[model samples]
Target chain A: MPWRRPRKKVERPIEVTRSIEESLEDAAAGEEEEDSVDLAGLDDATVVEAATGEPEPERGASDLALKLRETLAREPAPARARPRATTYPESGVDLAVDAARGLRLRNPVLTASGTFGQGIEYAELIDVARLGAIVNKGTTPNMRPGNPQYRIAETPSGILNSIGLENPGAVEVARRYGVQWAALGVPVIVNVAGYSVEDYVYVVSEMAGTPGVVAYELNVSCPNVKDGMIFGSDPSLAAELTRAVKAETDLPVIVKLTPNAPDVVAVARACEEAGADGVTAINTVLGMRIDTRRRRPILGTGSGGLSGPAIRPIAVHITYQVAQAVGIPIMGAGGVTSAEDALEFLMAGASAVQVGTATFADPLVPLKVIEGLAAYVREHGLRSIREIVGTALPRMVE
Target chain B: MIIQQGAVTASARIGDLGTVLGVSAPGIAAQARAGQFVHVRPGTSFEPLLRRPYSFNRIRRQEGEIELIVRPLGPGGEWIASRRPGDLLDLLGPLGTAFVIHRSARNLLLVAGGTGIAPMRVLAEQEASRRNVTLLMGGRSVAYLWPSDRLPPSVEYVTTTEDGSFGIGGRVTEALPELLRWADQLCACGPWPMLAAIGRMREEAERAPAAPGRAALLEAQIAVEQHMGCAMGVCRACVVVTSQGNARVCREGPVFPLGDVAFAEGEPATVGLVS
Candidate 1:
């Protein structure tokens, strides 16, 4: 049987490009940096010496400064203007971020549940191990066939889907994917969904000791199921469900909040009060589309959850609100398509961000987000990504 | 399956039928099989959020090229159909199951409706040399039909049009009976209504075990289409009800046994645990 174990950092061949910090130090020491360097604050004498390997001759310092300034102005800022990082990080930079209260992941970018499959499908085309973790399709105690044809409908910039949490059930999921998830070398956070508090406890109990599974994401806000949003919409109900699930397993429990909730911040605060480890700021917003020809709702279900770039603003807003209301880390999920979008969530106080609908268009987006995050860290010269978390949050009044 | 950028080597319009794009993707071309499809990213933008799935219209292995028949149905299709030579396309494929032919079957029959002609054309070219291949295609009008000159010389081509502007005047099912008796095996790919029509024929033939061409109808295989997302078996958006319960069209299918698939009242049956 496959069991969870500590993942060792596999040594990767380092690329020739040095970190920006190193380049900065080398520039001040009169050493030639590999390619790009920032010479913004260095004196004219130092700049001339570095460029021509000889000290500037005795002359009018102002004239020499003007000539040097003209030369510098003619050249482009190669450090900032160079090509964006398109490849994975070579070494020595930490991209780790907290996925939960104590669940530190290797990166802050993860594939949202349902969009990434069992984490094995896209493993063929891109590197799955590069992600912080993969949340499998929402799991229930029993198998579900899911909704009918027209289960998906495209909206303005997103898609409306009522997949109804189609999965092989929790027992089969742990038995089938446990080994594969362990072998894939990525953490698994099972997205648990159900109709009752007992249902949530049962799924967590069943998946308790599954290998490679680091946490449980309670999907209280799935809009496709009958009364699926009941727990998420009510704070007392959300807390009661969270407390019961927390009693069943030692794994971290993250409650996924619904934007449809009348008071999302209260629900998040209640979950945190009930021992929930973290919360996903927002689930898909309830929406629908009409077929002009048929004069009926396009989705099999009259309304489905809307996800994609269309909901990014809503997700970020909810994340910022929930971050202020609770002390638990928030996993921001919506239509996060790029590193900039992910950064929006990180600065808004989300510990990590999940990539969903965007994966449908480009399978490599999760990896690209990771690469972009590392690039962001290097360019800004930040010691770790955590320093930027909540950077944009409103400062608390003393 | 592989995800790679392929350059457009050839592009042409087939009357009012659709545009056939020839892409040079050696990796995908080498791995492609009949009935398999490629999920193509429409453009660099994200407005058209999902990749479009297109069946392989032609697979030229030695030349390291594959072709797709694309109809401009929506924004995504329009962008892909308007591609010019030397344009690069991001493709994720050769994915899903392929149509399987019994080696001993000497007479093979293929059926296509509308853009479903993509895979049928592939099979006709691949099976023509070793078997007696016959192609029966149906379209809305003469302009919507595939050019006969594009197919191999050894294959027998038949046509039908709803408007009676081309070959035998009617849907493909109308001309299907005459050839059913001669065919040892059959394969089809088309819109849901056409596939459901063939499913009906198979059901009727099953009730009469001794009927002419019963074996061919029983062994027939077909490809299906649906509103898809991800096309990587994750979203569960393109599932269809079958004998084994709900199967993803982008994964377990896009190809399945004729009898295993379920249809209701000339349309794909609604799938779920509830009624």
Candidate 2:
């Protein structure tokens, strides 16, 4: 057991390098000159270069782009130089905010479904509401007691958990949290999983009308279950499931893929063609843990999915592949606990990032990652994240 | 709810106590209770990402620090074994509900597992500080029992071990009937089976009248352990069933009145114990 320490008394304004906060006060000093630099319409390489190739800030690489916002200490008249931010709030000291598919976020970081709870409990230790959005733990069709004991097994640098998607089903969830979700200041993405294709469609369709839910993530990669995960691995099955959910609701549907698949692109493409609005790249990598004393598998389910920093590179690879194959935005995940890691995924092709296992280790990982991203962009003189999306894909097969 | 691993103040192998490590935090001693625990923060080890909950064993007034006693289970527990004085560790604190003692209750019977003594030690000390207190401590053997050096001399002590290697063995509950007959209030902390047995003992004793003076007091309180997630109740990993359904052991309580909580037969869950 660990003990506490005296709270550190130091309080300093969070550091900033380059951004609008510094320029806001200068409006009274000069005429309005629009800095409307559009990186869009630029070829993919140029946009990528504009985003990733710009010189990084010298003061702090770990500082989030939002943090580096050098705003004028005093407010000045609004001129053409500063156009009103599109729907998203820019006044926050942290700059992870952006808008996509009608969803507004504080940052580009979130916890993968099943990795974080409803976002209330960690509030005392972590800034839960400050995150881009919180994806509640995966909810199933019926109340699941979950797997037997020893559900989690530690690995060399990761964890294998066969929680079996334990949760209170949809109706009860709506009964318990419908009001709270509506009240939260941030967007709430609910992750849904099921035992059968019909189960998946039902959960999705039900969530479509559920209040407080802005988007739904379909779990297709869980290795702990006997049924739901298999559909995620088979392209045809995934396509059918996606189509079924599409026919039932108009909500933005994000198909969460499994790294266990032989070709993740096949699964991603299938979901896209079937009408998924977007894709969340790479779920946990299938893994196992053993107990020598019992001469048996450590987890009751025999196998679990591996998460944390161990799966980062694989997630990036899958994200890159899927981005090229699909037209909708991609949400990248797996071991992304830092801003640089988020940047890596954005360069790889994901429009956003999720920090999963790192949340357990450090309550502040997501908030820090968001700030870090903004700091990265500002230091390099990039005006918007659109400049860097998919910056790392090769210009050609060269 | 503020959880952060602090540096280790000291680590030692106390005879029979298994291993003892001290984390440097000033707040826990002032705020921690007998049944509540701080989730152990995740260490560099991959086995456990969450903090481990340890019962507060002893608070040395002279040192102005708290101590935790535990047995090594794996790399995670062994990590606790590896700490040296001044080594920082992840600590989340003053967690769970405490053993509730009514002001009217005088006599107290305290039951403990190998090192479940951590938090109970504080209760013992607090009660001993003001009034009379008796402790009925159970262990696997005399060696598995914590030495009295960390405890106050004022605590009236009773001992029992499984092998009868020291005091009366068989089971800790065996010692409880006598204590339950005498104590106005009882507090127990130990492995689930021992706790359940103690729970059973309380049930049997409830059928009989309390020794003359103690009529209004209900049953004893037992600390239930489970897989603790964020210690903040975010994961809902630490759960216990009650008439009201499941409640988080980490957030609702490690200490709960035996009569109020629903009991299920299963293996003991050592959640935040690895922090």
Candidate 3:
């Protein structure tokens, strides 16, 4: 049986480009009296035409346009002078933001904890330098062999995992990956998880001076282990754990919130009150799946953390609510697979976005998100990505 | 490992086994080994989200082609199985560790079940010229057996079906003891139950007196399978308990020493190994 479909070659409509050019010309004529043509809203093709006095290349045209626009946007010219520059920006678009107190990243795209695996695994597939930061897997005071077989199961537009905070303990993680992390170029954020406050403190202390580690993301929201969600679900316990980690090290402490918590916003506030430098709004939601054939749960742990595009909307809602309640910068995470998904968090008041389950589907997703964000910034004429943060929030009347 | 958009050169169904897809991916084919696999995307979008892992069924470097045996078990599998010539496939491969055949071993035995014949076929083609090779395959029916004509002529092909419609009846395990005495090494790939059966046999051989084939079974290396994500070794989703603790099937294996793997209750032993 031959199961082949005839290959369909997509033909780009040439009229689309002509029509865009016509509209750009009209906009340019109308703006001539304003002393400067706002080419910001123009499509990349028209931007390339206006900048280089030539048509865009069939391939890599958008990338070239972004690079050119970034360069022009950086170097300021006299009020009415024509913008001309062939150089690429030394530092690309201002995608940088204060991820945590004293923890500033070069960009706002970070690889989420657990999914990044100490940053070594994906380095073979993508350039680690392109990411804002890499959050290593959750580390505990003792080595964890993790959960049993059937650790993963696919759900609609998502996956459920019961990894159970598997790691080689804090000391071993620092010893095994410290030197490598130092040379990886990307900043490292250690995700600390444990059954007790001492476990969290011990892990923090052990990883304190490890090279390349810029901060700590307290993983109190891991739902796969016993007592893992206790701190995350309670305000006092969350504050106590945050305070313990803060006392153990001077590194910025960011608490990852659990959506299963009774009041996620209250927990965020509690962490902030306990001196947390930042907050990551929303970890995976608690979920389960049953194998119909076997008439039992699919995961070995009975239930697992649900993540992917299916949870993106829930994550955004939590981020929106938490952003309104807290002053600390929020690191939004859920099922962010695209730049548009990341943009939703940013507009809802998140300073950066962590890509988790999406990486399992496409390792290049985080890099693609970075590029897409740059395109969005250029298209909107935004001076800095920080300007877009909290834009969706209700404003107070004067 | 490189990620490439491979073009499907051919896709066809073979009896009751499933669809076989030939992909023109030079990079993957050039580096692919017997036991390693490729993670293939089902569609352009994330609806059927995760990529399915398939071992290399055939690798032709000169033609820059690699073939995969796709069993249409789910929506993702069905989509991949139905792909036609000239279709672009997103592939990340030549991943996981390959089977290691000892240089001194002159007689090699390979066991396969159902679609697990993929990696075994590669071993037969690769090691036939270097050593005396025999392959034992088992299926529920004759329709599920791999075609004997497709294999290298030098390979000794043995088959068993549950319904006795093919070669020997029952299972590969029934034919394994006799062949164990003649072989110097054993390697297998199949469902967990089959591997568990082999695991049990290995345990019995260890407890008994030293025999010609018992050493080979004890030293056997088998490629294992599990529900996987990210195949890049980051997700920690495909881990199985081993003598060395939890090991990711996508990285540390797909291939592992039979003795090192801990199987319990007909599935991978998941409890009590660690606290």
Question: DockQ: which is higher, 1 or 3?
Answer: 1
Largest TM-score belongs to which candidate?
A: 1
Residue ranges of candidate 1 with Cα displaced over 4 Å: A1-87, A222-229, B273-275
TM-score of each: 0.86, 0.79, 0.86
Alpha-carbon runs more than 4 Å astray in model 2: A1-106, A204-211, A222-229, B5-7, B10-12, B27-30, B42-48, B59-64, B203-218, B240-244, B260-275
**lDDT (CA) per prediction:** 0.83, 0.65, 0.82
Task: Report the lDDT tens digits of candidate 2 across residue range B1-275.
Answer: 34444667877787777677777666555565567676565465434554566777766555646678756766666676677787777776767677777687778777888777666777888788666678878887888776777668999888888899988877776876666667777777777777766655555657866464233225677787775555665555566565445566776677777666654453443222121
Q: Rank candidates, lDDT, best first.
A: 1, 3, 2
Which residue pairs show backbone clashes in model 1?
none
Model 3: residues with Cα > 4 Å off, grouped in runs: A1-91, A222-229, B272-275
- In candidate 2, residue B46 scores what lDDT? 38
Superposition error at A219 for model 1 (Å) = 0.5
Query: What DockQ do you compute for every candidate structure?
Result: 0.37, 0.29, 0.30
| Superior by DockQ: candidate 1 or candidate 2 | 1
Residue A283's lDDT within candidate 2 is 86
Tell me the TM-score of chain B in each candidate.
0.98, 0.87, 0.97
The global Cα lDDT (0 to 1) of model 1 is: 0.83
